[model samples]
Target: MPKLRLKESLAGLKKIKININFKKKEKQMPIPPPPPKPIPRGLKIIEKYPLYEPFSHVVIVQNPKTGEHQYILDELQLDPLERGVYDRILEILLAEIESPKEEILDPRKFFAESAKKIVDKYRISLGWLPDVSWYKILYHAERDLVGFGKIDPLMRDPNIEDISCDGVNKPVYVWHRNYESIETNLQFPADEILDNTVVKL
Candidate 1:
C-alpha cells in the first residue's frame, strides 16, 4: 500500500513539470507586434510674384497629407485703411492712363507715394516693385483694368481671355468667349504706349 501511494505522488509531480515546460516554451516563442510606421514630414509653403505684373501674385500652401499645393487668392488680410488707399491709388492710375492728359501731370507720383505709404505702414513688399518705377505703375494700371474694369471686377473674374491695347489712338481689345473680340476706343500717348507695352511683355 505504501509503495502504490509513492508511485501516485511521483506521477502527479511529473505531470506538473510537463505543464510548466509547456508554458515556458509558449512564452519564449511569443509573436512580436509589428514594427511601428515612420512619421511623415510636414508641408511646405511658397509665395511667388510675377515680374513686371501688378497683382499677378501667387501664394502656394502645400499639404503633405494631400500632396497638393493650394493656390490661395484673396487670402491677404489688409486693414480697411489699406484697402481704401489701394483703391484710391488704383482709381487715379486708371484715370491718368486712360486719358493721359499731360506728361507733366503724370499720376505716377500718386501711385508711388500711395504704394510706398502702404508698404511702409503694412510692411508689405511687392516682388516686382523692389525698385519702384514708372513701368510698375503702368503694370498696375493694366492689372486694374483687367481686375477692376467694368468688364471684370478686377481679380474677381478668372474667365477673361485677353486684355490688349494697340495704341492710345486705337481701342483697347478684349477677347470674350461670347463676343469673340470687342474693341473700346481707349487711347494713350507715345510715352504711355511704349511704357505699357514694354512692361507687360
Candidate 2:
C-alpha cells in the first residue's frame, strides 16, 4: 500500500509541471516598438550656423528659391540679454508690415540704404572724404575706413542682424532681424574670393 501511494504522488508532481509550461506558452504576448521622434523646423539654419565651442549669437536666413536656410553672425555680437532687445525691434517691424497698404515700407531697402548713409556721414565727420571726387570717395571709403578683408557695409545697419561670406563673388548672406535671412537667390563660386576682388577693382 505504501509503494502504491509513492507512485501516485510522483505522477501528480509530473502533471503539475506540464500544466505550468503549457500556460506559460499560451499566455505570451507580442511587444510593440516605440514611436519615432519629430524633426525641428530650425534644423536647417542650425546646420549652417552650427554652434561651436563658444555659443555665439546667430542669425539664420532662408533661401526663397531652394527653400533652404543659412546662418550668419551679427557684427555687434551681443550677449543673450542684448539679443532680446534686437529681437523686439524685429518683432515690431514684422507686425507693422502684416497688413500691407499701397506703400508698404520695404525694410530691406531701408536698412541697406540707411546703413550706407551712416558710413558716409561718419567719413564726412572724420574728414576722410575731403575734396576727393565724390564717386571716388564713395567707392573707396568702404575699403579705407572699414578693414578690407572681411568688413561689410551692411554691418552698419541696425536692422541687419547677421552677415556671412562663404567666399567673394558669392552672394553674401544677411539676416534681417525682422525677416529671416534673405537668400538673394545667389551663391558664390568655390573661388569667390578671387573673383570678388577682381570685380571690385
Query: Candidate 1's residue-wise lDDT over 1-201, tens digit each?
Result: 011000011111110000011111111112222222222246455443321123333333456676554332322222355445455555544444332233434233444444445445433433223333323343344333422222122123233256555443544454433434544323335444334333322
Backbone collision tally, model 1: 5
Model 2, residue 182: distance off in Å is: 0.8
Give TM per candidate.
Answer: 0.25, 0.26
Evaluated at residue 47, the lDDT of candidate 1 is: 42
| Model 1 steric clash pairs | 147-154, 147-155, 148-154, 168-187, 168-188
Candidate 1 matches the true fold with a TM-score of 0.25
For residues 37-130, what per-residue lDDT tens digits would candidate 2 score against the true structure? Answer: 2234544443322111122124455545567765444322333543443344333333332322234244233433443555454444343322
lDDT value, candidate 1, whole model? 0.34
**Model 1 lDDT, residue 19, Cα:** 8
Question: Cα lDDT of all candidates, in order?
Answer: 0.34, 0.34
